[model samples]
Target: MDGIQEFNPFSAGGLDQHNDTTIPISDRSSQPAVLQPSQEPTPKASASAAQVELLRQQEELERKAAELERKEQELHSRGVSMGPENNWPPLPRFFPIKPCFYQDFDEEIPVEHQRVCKMMYYLWMYHCVTLFLNILACLAHFTVDAGHGVDFGLAILWFILFSPAAFICWYRPVYKAFKSDSSFNFFFFFFMFSFQVVVYIIQSVGIPSWGNSGWIYAISVIGTNLAVAVFMMVVAGFFTVSAVLSVILLKMVHGKYRNTGASFQKAQQEFSSGVISNKTFQSAAANAASTAAQSAFQRN
Candidate 1:
């Protein structure tokens, strides 16, 4: 009985031991199945990941290319060139005129002479305004005296003529003088502007029936009519101011010219160049030579 009990096939302890061993084997098999799926990725998922990686690389390449292009453009604008190609005076798009004729003021005008150039330009603008006011003053006078038509007409003519003439005679010459540092242009502008200053003084004098209400009209109309007197006074004041400014500018320009050595030597050279270039002078010289040769031949 004791041996049967010890080797019993229906024992609870033996069944429990067997169940524990079998449970371990089943858990091991389940772990391997779970790990196998994780180790081997699906074909569709791998292909999608590869496509995403290629797209990321393409974007990175494009970004690098754009950065390089931006750097190249920046260098080009600063007068830096790759290879032998250089663009100077980088022209504006849709501009009809060439950049050579209209130089960039900020880049071309020297720092030393910029102030003088600006002052000269301002003077020109002042002159234009003065002329316009003169016309208005003439019209006012015309309203008072219908016979002052001549004054109005002459004022208009002066504006039309002087505007262009001033630009051509003084402004452009001074501009060229500063731009090129030419002694001849400096002398030309000095002489021309000197005459212009004299003209300003004369215009400020306010001659009657002449389109200006200078000091003369301002004083003359004082007791006649207060309103007209005030108007004349205002006009006279404008003229006086214009005259004073013109004188001051003339002095300033003269000082600059002196500093540039626009002396008698430069004047002579300019005059000689002009005479040589003049057709009338050339013709006169030829005639004189011919007459002298005829006299010499006759004497022989």
Candidate 2:
């Protein structure tokens, strides 16, 4: 009793203290942590990149479409509209002779055909200039040798005749052919232009007594008058250049014609149709028939 006398209710034993102790949160930290599953951003990142590429492609296509639209607008502005005013022949308002033809490369000719058509126009101009220069050269020749007066006369005659004739026969036909895509006009141009090429070759050759200031006449005059001969030679060179250009242009036109689906049969058809549809032809036919009827009635 004396040795165990100090045990009281306020004092706790070791087993009782152990039974009341609680485990701390840090004690469980070493156990494998049960974390919520995190989503991988790789699929989302790839999807965003794909969307960005698609957007870039779409923007590129839009830019191309805008560029094409701009080009089309420019082409339209270049006189593709209907009923555009003609600016060719560029004659002054006060001139006695008005422009007879309505010529506009942008309005009348297709873009692909305009270049060759313009070249043909320039060739015609060159041909005119060559003829004028030939006349001058022939005049000089005549001044040196009065016996060559025939060449001067013929040169004047050729200048007067061939200038208009070339324009009407070959140039106009080709112009109309390009303007309307007429098979008959194209064939007519080919025929006339072929003859023109031959004439150019002849003129370049400078045969004696011919109106042309060709190589032969130029060389002949060289002994008599070197100044006149040099001048004539220069003109002869021009004729040669004209001939070469004519040949080249002829081939170019033929190539264009081949692409036009034109044929001899089509040309014939176009000719017949054009003749039938022409007001002048119809009037002439009617007058001829009336005259024939009157003659027959009187005979009866």
Candidate 3:
């Protein structure tokens, strides 16, 4: 110890020498460090690991339920109700129904009246053309005999009897159909048409007074080529068909009339008490008046 050399650290008396036995913290810092939980690197695996599976299952179940609910909603919205009574869309008023005895077309309709009118009009034209052809064919008989086939008296009688029948059975019913939506007119047309069919059959068979023997299918008729007799029958047959078709058209129009929101309350009233004062009727009339006014306004 006496031989130890003196430190030449610039003869510094600032050197600390108070506790040589105790090592300084910096000199012996290799001891295992006490790690703090807050300072440690976080685990890559989520801490919510246990909850994750639960959440996934919950979400999956929720999605399944939502899908089921969505399917139900879609079916409901697609105009398809699931219940027995709710299985179909609303039916239009123009379903398989009989013709109305009265018609009042002034309101919006699910189906257009114009379309029905066009069908009827076309049929009418077809009937007219057919009638004309038939008449011309029958006239051939008269042409062949000239004076003897259908004399003036016979012609006058035929015209008188048949013309009135045509008007009453066919023309009047058609006229009613055009003027109003009437079930009676429709029935009239059907009835008249049926009668005409019988007449046509009679004439086509050449049953003497009705059908022509000069035109097509002349072999079926009784007359050979007597133009007057043949022509008159053809004419009569055509008109007979016309009468029947007039009834059919009347029925069709009547069907469309129901879709028009037309009410036969007046007719009902007439049938019931010869007058109308029911609330339903009063409101209906008011609505009609309002609708007409609005239409007029829009037109203006």
Candidate 4:
């Protein structure tokens, strides 16, 4: 009975022992602990990742800056402007005379002023054509009346001299004024173009022996040769049209100038500054000063 009691499976003590045995092992050296709530991301690791991202952004910005610098250097090396290049006088690549100026109405002129600028360009072209035709008319006049040789020679001289002079003086100044809103250029255009208008009037009047085929000359030849008179009349009509257009354009330009907010003070300031900055002007001034000093010293 004693042995049985000691080994009893249903005894209170034995049941208590079994309950203790069934409890999980406290000393589990081989089993891994449950993934302890994944350790909170370390601040250091997070900082490292952020730094990496920053480095990538910094590298990208540096690359863009380097590329921009490279492009600027390339442009400088090629002697090209960062803005649009000059493509005026769009001559053929093979032409002996390269373009002397750069003109782009769309690029340089304001949208509001482009129409007026284009009209001015057209006027210049018409002026050139008129001069050329005047030469032909004068040749015909000379043919009909041998005494008109002076008229023919003067016509040739006017065509040669006036064509380029008009382009350089009044037309170019107006073009520059519209392009840059330059106060100095505006004033220059006003002064020069006013004179040009007067010249146009005189040309249209066709003073005899003055190298113009104007109304007076045309009427004078009416009884001499009908065909020649008609030819001269046609040329005279062209001169009349040129004069009228010049007057109209001069008025238009004056109106535009009034709207430009350019003052005489501003024009004077620009002129002074331009003269000071011009290398050629500087040299000329220095030479003149030196000469004056020498002359004064010699007089003493």
Full-model lDDT for every candidate? 0.75, 0.91, 0.54, 0.89
- In candidate 1, what are the lDDT values of residues 1-300, reduced to their tens digit? 656756554698878767755655455654444533467779999999999999999999999999999999999898666654323335666766433334344655677677777788778878888788778766776677687688778888888988878878998788777776678888888889889877778787877766666777556656655676677667677767877877787777677777775677876787789889999999999999999999999999
Best by lDDT: 2
Off by over 4 Å in 3: 1-111, 118-135, 145-168, 171-180, 211-217, 220-300
- lDDT tens digits, residues 115-150, model 4? 888888899889999888889999998997899999
Model 1 residue 218 distance off true place after TM-score fit, in angstroms: 3.6
Between candidates 3 and 4, the one scoring higher on TM-score is 4
TM-scores for all candidates: the values are 0.55, 0.68, 0.33, 0.70
Winner on TM-score (1 vs 4): 4
- How many clashing pairs in candidate 2? 1
Residue 105's lDDT in candidate 4: 87
Q: Model 2, range 10-45, lDDT digits (tens) per residue?
A: 557644666557577787768676887867768889
Error of 1 at 13 (Å): 99
The stretch of ten residues in a row with the least summed lDDT in candidate 1 is 97-106
Which run of 10 residues does model 4 get worst, by summed lDDT? 20-29
TM-score of 2: 0.68
Instruction: Rank candidates, lDDT, best first.
Output: 2, 4, 1, 3
Best by TM-score: 4
